[model samples]
Target: MKQTMTNLKQLIRAGRGIVPAHTVIVNGNLVNVMTSEIYKADVAIYEDTIVAVGEVKDYIGEDTKVIDADNKYLVPGLIDGHIHSECSKLSITSFAKAVVPCGTTSMISDLDEYISVSGLEGLNEIFEEVKASPLKVFWGAPYKTPYTFPQSTVSYNFTKEVHENVQKWPECFGVWETVREAVTEEDENTLGAIVEASKNRLPVFGCAPMARGKELNGYLCSGVRLDHESYDHEEVVEKMRKGMHMLIRESSVTHFLKENIRAVTEVNPYLARRVSFCTDDVTATDVLEKGHLDNLVRLAIKEGVEPMTAIQMATINSAEAYRIDHLVGSISPGRIADILFVDDINTFNVEKVITNGKLVAENGRLSYELRAPKRSSVLTSQLKCKKTTKEDFEYKVDIKDGKAKVLSMNVKGPFVRKRRDVVLDVKDGIVQPDINKDVLMVSVLERFGRNGNKSLAFCSGWKLKKGAMASSAAPDDNNIIVMGADAEDMSIAVNHLIENGGGQVVVADGKVMEFLPLPVGGIASDLEPAEIARLENIINKAANELGCELPEPLMYMFFLPITAIPDYAITDVGPVDCIALDTFDPILELMEN
Candidate 1:
């Protein structure tokens, strides 16, 4: 059957829109975020798309279902241009069920989390599940991934031995190296992958620090078009000047750069049109604890952005950046019948939400069908860590008698530093850190099962109880990471995690107190948003009880391997000195010199 909208059928169709179903939204001020215009009108829907929007006297018909807006605001559907569908901490269907109630009608995801644990087939399966949702979810490929990113744990490709991997490489013409060199950009595969996406006439996203002037230009020269990693105003100006649409991001790893955005807004008001809002990665708890794209809209308004302008950034700017403005960014005919009922632009709140000409949420409560997605590749992907030796987690350091100096990177969320050194105590082969001294060991194990790929480095933060504490952002289906105090509790956590397949867990006193079983890609769950939040509290309290303080325990868990931002990030490869833009050999070397 032809797509109800041509696009949906060609991609992932969830049935179709029932046409000519009479529905009148009367007595509302419709704000067209695209043209930055607002007018009093009564909108009419004839199926899944809006038929007309103006005065209702001209839209009268028998058997029409009239919704008295009671003079509420009717704007276009809120669309998040870039997101990690995995961030919902729910399966596609469960995710859709949660966000639909928040006035989020459509979302575009990088699918990085799924791909990291599954593969292309896994991504395709997710697309199929997202297809069956009430909200619209579009798929975009990721630009950069952690060393853990390639999904080798599932079906990743980096070898010339694999026919499928080799087939995808001839598509490359220039240097498109790994995400490792966002500065030098030496990999040709990156360009080839993006060009392949462009060849398919799809909007692909680019990932780079955007601080390297020449590298930024080269990335644009490749097929990648949009960028969501502008960390500074200087970078944003350069990108906009070079005609790149910048996605102002507030991810779990990076929040909106306050001074940077403020400075940009002060200098050039016109640049606002080129800027859009995106949440790269967030947990399900943050969804309830904070909000979705709505948070970005609120922040922009508070940061001196005109409320209408903020709406334009999140709605029109986003749609236009990805070339979908005509479809969901504004109140127009032939567009999906998605609208947000807001009482005020400032201090935005979801009063009601209508999607596909149907009311699914009223005052943040679900009013329609929302269920778990049918998963096709849940635990099918696995990496045999049978090769991982216990020695892989152990390291030896020579102590020069009385005192020893060790190198470390203080963990302050996602940002890393290149600071040369610090001092520590050396005992029992491992260099022990003084907890009162505020120093600790941070490590990233190659759960990809590669021998000698484990990275161990020192970082400051996490004051655990009487045991050892650890956390892993490992995106492997078999990835079971334990975070807690003491060896016995850690063992208990690991056993519990293995029992549950794989997911994030927190342990204490030899018991599996709490865990979020992510059997699906080992990144997200098939649970409700509220359920994720409830279990997440156990983690937060565990952190607090042990004195592991930062902010949100799980919310702050995103920084272990973010290479783009400046943080002493450790990966399966090693401790990356980001500011220096190089890997530290035996991390202690940095501290000694």
Candidate 2:
């Protein structure tokens, strides 16, 4: 209360010109997001809050720091409406360094993957890192863990008690994604979390991809008002018409923005008022080479969206979605002084970034040093599985030396999978993978050292002709998932991850070709973004050398274990028909155990 009163008094004095402002930006064309206007103006910042936005020569005293923008466009700092920092495989501090220079000042993250591995006890460790960094992190308390019931294994389940505790934390602003499948099925945890978020007056983010009519209605009745999983422009228009705040996602592998933005460019331009942008799950390689939300703005503008609307989508629209518009999303009085100077609105090239009234980055580089956090002991010891062997990944069949017909999970893409029936040669009671048929062996092993559970299934879309790829950064469960044509290479990949605590690895002919160490919680690395990107490029290169044609193979494989999406998924339990929400036998014929 005392701090608020003092701040109010200081703001009054600064605005009235009785006291000098800490910083002043002159001769700038301010991109007013709230009013959708760009006009020549000067901004006055008192401490870290904007005090005035018009002619501010009176506020420029002897101690005031003056910056000559020279008629550059002054825009608000970019905001990522939805992101998973853990998906970048970079620690909190490292992730900040990657995006802050790209003019990103804020990010709303659920941190669901990290919580699934470290549990609620490790929340404070992440918060400690968030405090020491320049980026502002808005956390969303996830509704549940594992993403599906009986489909995957996770160390911690998001109970009502956990939700109750996290909702009271200052960093937690709202409920994270409410899975459409879970809500429509009346999952107790999800429904109860929504109720608690409403009681606290917090927004409920949603996830409903490819839903329509009755299914979408049923999910919306649960009070989820925001969605980020629209697959096309029609889906985006349908959700926007139903009063859903749509977030057009353009991640490293998923390129939905080109199609989804058509909802505003071609269909209804007014619907963009409720639209925002997010990079749901991106890699370090994408962030280092391509700009963060700034890239999205450029794409939106090129797609025929007005420049102001594109900037608004990257800024104010997201802040309004989370009800934090009063604190950010615009360069208005009483808001934090996070402003960006760009010479070209069409290209969206960032020249200078002023966050909290301090110049932190310029010309795509951070001027000030960003120190990374020390590795925490709590997150470094997450991988606890035993060393795997060739026998662990075997898909045994009843036939002694004949061909066997089995059900295989065929990847249509990264998000959709279908059950494919294929015939494979049976050699000595083992169903051998057919490299000619593009049928490869895929398995998920429980890595928590609790159950040591392991399951096997066949996959075909990977197209790995000779080698194997494995990763512990799989979504929701964060378990070890390996896919390969040869069992020996599969074993080598899994054991390599186990030996290094956790990470992504590719092995060919029983030799590790590339590895990216995720020593923190077996999901994130403490290294800088450049180093992470270097390892990711080499890993993709190794996968390409092994005959995999998919772009971002490691990223595509990471989503295979998540049962929240549609069609089918494979976990440590077995192959699951996600639509039916049940496990199915891989063998088509009934066989004796």
Candidate 3:
């Protein structure tokens, strides 16, 4: 409180011309996001707040630091409206180190992936660690966990206890993407949580892909203010027309920003203010190779949006969507001194980054030190489960006949939203998968030390000629999900993950080929960003050799169990028809022939 009062007094004195400014940035073409104008101006800062803009010669003093922008573009530091830091496969400190130099000064992250394995205690630890970083990190409370009962091992139902706890946290900006089940089913617990967040004046982020007309209206009427899951230009324009903020997303798994930005340039350019850019999930390799939010801004410009408008989408527009424009999103009086120096507006190449009136990164290098926080013992021990055997992955047929019908998971592309029915020969009371027809066995085992529940089903589209792959980073639940043509290799892959605590593993011919261990909460690693990228590359290469066909094989494989997306997904309970929000039996009874 004392420090806040002192800062306020300092700002007042600097603004009233009674005191000299602590720093002054002179002779830069300021990209004013509020007015969508670019003009030569001088920005003066006192402590951590921008005290003045335009003419600030009177505020300069003997001790004030002056930085000549040299006729370059001075834009507000970029903000990622929605991201999952855990997806980077690095700790919060390392993740900050990787993106700060790319001009990303602030982010609103979802802890749902980490919370799925470690629970609320892990979430609090991550929140505190991010708070101590030089970059600004905001929180979005996880709304969907253990998505369905008996299917997911860890149950976080947004009860009264969870609601009260999240509301009291100062870092929480809103509730993260609410699932369709809660809205359609009108679950009292989830709806009550949404009401509580709304009463506290926090926005609710939602996920509704391919929803149109009445379905979209029902979702919007349920109090969801923002969406990042629109798949096409039509969906983007329609959602924006109905007053929903759309976050155009481009990430390792999917790329929709180019297509969605067309909605602004072709259909409704006036609605650009309601559109923003976000990398919902990115890997360390991608950040190092392609860049962070800077990549999104550059792509938007290349796609024909004006550079200034694209910058606004990445900065002020996102801030307004989250109701944080008053605190950030522009270079105005009383806002934090988060600024970026760009060589050219067309290229969006960030040369330097300043946050909170301090130089944090220059010339693609960080100026400050980043320290990884010590994790708790319980959170570190995330892969607590028994070893598996080939017998555990076997599926016994319930039919006494020669052949049985089964529902097989089909994957035409990276996204697993479609399934088909197949008939398999039943031999000796057991149904075996037919790899010749691209049908492979998939399983999810409980690893949270709860009841050792396991579910099995058949899937296509992996295109794996031979071998198996297993990962504990399954979306939403973080369970050990493994797929293989041979049951023995599947057992080897699952056991490898169990021994390594948690990670991605590839096995062929019952031998462990490659593995990347993620010890932090079973999803994140404490390793350096470069090393993580290197290890991931090796894992992907090994997976390619084993016949996996997807571009980012692990990323697509991890989301196969995400029941929130659409159509179908597999979980510990059974195969879920996501559109209907109910579980279905994997087996099908064949007609008498």
Candidate 4:
């Protein structure tokens, strides 16, 4: 509150000419996101707030540091409306170092990945780490925990006590996206939690992908004000028409901006105010190679979006969606001096970045040091699962006669979310995976030392003919998920992950091939971005060598256990029908042929 009063005084004093500004940018073309206009101006900064704009030569004091813009385009520092810091495979501090240089000054992060591992303790740890960073980080409480029946391995029951505790944190912006299946099912516990979060007037984030007509309306009626999963322009337009803020996302796993940005550029440009850009899930490799939110803005401009409009979507639109525009989203007075200098407006090549009145990045390199988060014993000891054997992953089918119908997760691609049922031949009175037909055994084992639960099922489209892949980074649960043609190789991979405290592992012919250990909560690693990227590349190369046909083999394997997506997902309990929010029998009775 004292900081608020101090800012108000600075704004009033600067406007009255009673005090000179601390620093000034002379002769610059400012991209005003609020007005969607570009005009030549001089910006004056008093401390961390932009105190004046438009010809402020008199406000410059002798003690102030002046930066000559030389008519370069000044844009508000980019903000990622939604992201998961853990997806970068780096700690929050390391993730900041990687993105700040790319001109991402602020981000709203969903720490569900960490929360799913350590509950509220994990969330608090992440919040403190982010608070110490140079970037502006906003928190979104994990909305869906224990997302499936029989409970996830690291499930935190979203009880009233936990919800109240989450609300007490000032950094928490809102409850993150709720699973569509829970909302559609009208789960009283989920609905009550939303009400509890809304008591503070925070916006609820939604996750209703492919929800149309009444289903979409039902989700919105539950107080969800924003969605980041809309994949097409039609979905974007429909959501915007219904008063939902659409966050067009371009992540490593999915690319929706090239097609969805057209919703504003061609269909209804005026509705662009209701849309924003987000990187829901991206890795360090993508950020270092392709850029961060700046990549989204450049792509939008190249796809025929007006320069100012694209900037607005990346800046003020995102801020307004989260009700934070008054703080850090524009080049206006009383806002934080989070500004960027772009050499080319059309290409969005950011030359320099400033956050909180300090020069954080210059020439695409971080000019400051980023400290890693202090590790806790609990965080470092995430793998507590007992040793596993081939029997744990075996699927014993009781066949009295011949063939039996089976249910399989038919993955067409990394992004497709439908399951298919197929009939397969049973051999030796037991159901066996037909690797010759591209059918491989998939399993999810409880890894958080809870109940020792495990489930088995068959999957297609993995295209692995010789080896098995396993990772402890499965979404929402952080369970050990592995798919393999040979049960021995699968056991070797899962046991390696268990012995290494949790990580991604690939095994072929009962031999360890490639491994990347993530000792931090079994989800994130303390490794630097370059090292993590190197390990990830090695894993991908091994997967390709093993004949894995998925576009993003690691990501595909990780997301297989996320029950929030449509159709079917495997959990520790069994195969879940996501739309119905219920578990179905893995074995199907064979009909007489």
Candidate 5:
């Protein structure tokens, strides 16, 4: 309270010109996101707060540093409504280094991966690291961990007590993405976490992907107010009409902005108010090759959206949705001095960036020195599972000398899989993946040593002619997920990850093709963003050369164990029918010998 009053006094004094501002930007067109207008103005900053935004000649002093904007457009720094910093495969500090220069001033994360891997203590270690970054990071205490109860294994679980304990932290903005099934079923832990967040006066973020009608209503009744998983424009419109804030996501694999933004461009322009932007899960290569939220804003403008509306979606709308508009989201007085100088609104080319009244990035590169904090030992890889063998991945059938019918998973796209029944010839009671049918064997191993549990299933759609790809960075649970046309290569890929702590590896002809070690928590790396991007590019290319055709194949395989999406998914719990929550035997029937 004392600091607030003192800061208010300083801002008032600086606005009056009695106390000179620390920094001043002269001759720039201010894009007023709140009013949807653009006008020429000068901005005066008192330390880290904007004190004035109109004519500020009087606020200039000999010691005040003045920046000539050269008649460029000044817009509020961008904000990502929802993102998983871990998906970038970089430390939080390194993630900031990649995004802060792209004009992303703030981000909100669920920290689900960190919590599942290292628990409450690891979450705090991440918070301590955030302090060293120029980017502002907010947290949402996850309602549950291991994503699915008893189905997926993890190092820690987000119980009711864990939710209550994390809610006491000032950094926790709300409960994060309560599982759709949990909310629909009125699960006690999910409801309890929501109640605790409500008691603290915080909003609950949602993860109801493809939810409609009564199910969506039930989720809303549980107090989930935000969503980033709307599949299309109709879903966005329905959720918006239901009073839920929709975050249009443009991730590496899942692209919904081009289709979802139509709720504003075609359906009802008024719905734009409830719309914002998020990067839910992005790779460092995407951030380096393309921009972050700024890229989304540009794509929206090109998709028939008004430039001002798109900018608003990336800034004020997200800030207001997260209840942090007063702190950021605008270039108005009394807000944090996070601003971007752009050449045009149509192209959204950010020429310079100022965060906290300091010049940080210029010409697409960070201009200031940034050093990430040392990682705690708790963040290292927790993979305690033994090396896998080829026999472990063998698909066994009761029939010894005949063809067997099996229910295999056929991946349709990035997130959807369908159960496909395929008849394969069996030899010695063992069925091998049929390369002629483009079917490959997939397996998930419990890497936490909680159980040396390993589940095997056959999958199609990777189109791998030979060899294998594997990683210990599997999502929802950081176990080991591997897929291959050859059992020997699959064994090599999985063993390589085990011997090197944890990483993504490609194997062909019994030789290691490419490997990217995720030494930090087995889900993130401590390397520079460019280096990570380089390794990811090479690894994906290696998988392509081995005959896998999907873009970002390693990333797609990483989510095979995630049970949140749709149709079919496989975890260490064996093959799961995602829609029905039922586990079934891979072998459907055996032919007469």
Candidate 6:
């Protein structure tokens, strides 16, 4: 909050006096966003704050500066409720250059790709950049296990080290998206970290799906300040009733845009203002093609939402929820000069944008700032696999006798679906792939630490490729991903990953087709978003080479180990029941022998 206050004071003084002050804006609809009203005025500005805003001359002096705004419409600068800076496939600097021109002046970003650890010095570097930049960036601490989980048990992934650092540093606006299974009294590391945040008055975020009564209160008591995972509209109201801030999400994973707009304003009426909007995960490619906040704002309007209400969801409501309300959410005198000029208020299409009092974009075209990227320290990652062979992925499920029941685990939705214990006949001790059921082999390997921890299981969903469809998803490229029609193809996939050191790879019928060498954290590319997306497309084709028809290969690529959001999933050790948090029968129908 000090950040907001300091910036506010700087703006106040900067507009106080001088050569017509620095600059002036004249003759436009000065959007009095403070009350959702708009009025015509000859606006005057000095530096980054409005000095005088009224008809003709309300407070203008002799040496007033001005920019002709004859027939233009002005509104408060936009704020994205939540997004990831890393997901844009760019450094903070690069991402800013790209989006600023698109009129996104501020964002609450949760970059899980960057791990906060023992030193936390590196993480602080990024935080400092966020504070000092032209585009305001709000940070959220990562709740994801940086290099653990989905491999076997939740052990070795998250540790007390993260808790200790957060207890001391508290580098983010708050903790983001915590799972119940990831926390416990025995392992109160993250739990304690939340307590520390609460003591320090920092917000702790949570995701309690369909939770009620005790479960809901339990989550709030644990320090979760807000919830973005409330899917049902009733649950959204329930959370608000419980005094927890409700984050209405609209994204690829969950679509709740129109629903929330109706629920808050139409259905509940009283708690309308407590709700907000967010797109949890948007890739860099989508950032370029569809637009950032443009997509959501347009969707709301198209879906019959009031223009003012939609803007509030993206701007004012977000600011208040993050507790930075005093700094932004309006075009008042002391607020930062992040304003948007749109042609039409109802349609809400932006024609010009001013961020920090400088022109960032005009029309739909981005006035991109192609400069050197802001660098952060301590980014070290690689893919490691030794002597990978087709035989490594091959297994005989037959136990002594020709026929024995098998175990299968599966999840249905989210990234972590459900676990099942089904037994199937195993011939020659090897459980064969069930092409009819969309069940395929899956595995998760240790990437960062040198434990060589490899867990294996069977999953359903990929409609077969004759060979292995494999990828090493370390974002740091520290481990290999190998899955295929047979052990022979699986080995082929692993061998290619082994050769690349770290990246995504696919092998079919003994032929290497697609590979992405993400040697740095396996999640990011040193290259630009376009380049990475092009390779990602090739990887998509390779998934089709294995005869699968999914929207994006990476979605499936990510599903291999997500343990919370229920889905039929396979890990390095075995199939995981996300709800149960345990291994199940491979087939998940017949009893395990």
For each candidate in the order shown, give its overall lDDT on alpha carbons.
0.61, 0.88, 0.83, 0.82, 0.88, 0.61
Q: Which is superior by lDDT, 3 or 6?
A: 3
Cα distance off (Å), candidate 2, residue 235: 1.2
Name the better of 4 and 5 by TM-score. 5
RMSD of each: 5.2, 1.8, 2.1, 2.2, 1.7, 4.3
Q: Which runs of model 3 end up more than 4 angstroms from their true locations?
A: 1-3, 148-151, 155-157, 399-401, 590-593
lDDT of 4 at 369: 72
Candidate 4 lDDT, 377-424, residue by residue in tens: 757775767888888777776654467678888786555667666677
Q: Among all windows of ten consecutive residues in candidate 3, which has the lowest summed lDDT?
A: 149-158
Once model 2 is optimally superposed onto the true structure by TM-score, how far is the C-alpha of residue 355 displaced, in angstroms?
1.5
| Model 6 TM | 0.84
Worst ten in a row by lDDT for model 5: 1-10
Tens digit per residue, CA lDDT, model 5, 1-593: 12488778877898788999999999999999999999999999999889999999999999999999999999999999999888788888889889988899999887888887888888888888887677888788888887763357888878777777889988888888777887776778888899898888998988988999989987888888889898889999999999999999999999889999989989999999879999988999999999899999999999999999999999999999988898899999889899999999999998898988889999988897787767778888557898878898888777687887888888887888888899888889888688898888999998887878888988988889999999888788878899999899999999998898888999999999999999888889878899999999999999999888898898888878878878778888888878877677888888857
TM-score for every candidate vs. truth?
A: 0.84, 0.97, 0.95, 0.95, 0.97, 0.84
lDDT for residue 167 in candidate 4, whole number 0-100: 67
Return the lDDT, model 2, position 97. 82
- The CA lDDT at 372 in model 4 is 79
lDDT string for model 1 (402-521, tens) is: 345666666555544444366665455555556666655555544444452445666555666443333434432223333332435555554454455556666666555556666676
The C-alpha stretches of model 4 lying farther than 4 A from their native spots are 1-20, 149-151, 400-402, 590-593
Q: Which ranges of candidate 6 are over 4 A from the true structure?
A: 1-11, 18-20, 41-70, 85-94, 116-125, 128-135, 143-171, 180-187, 372-377, 384-387, 396-416, 419-428, 474-482, 567-574, 583-593
lDDT of 2 at 453: 84
Greater TM-score among 2 and 4 belongs to: 2
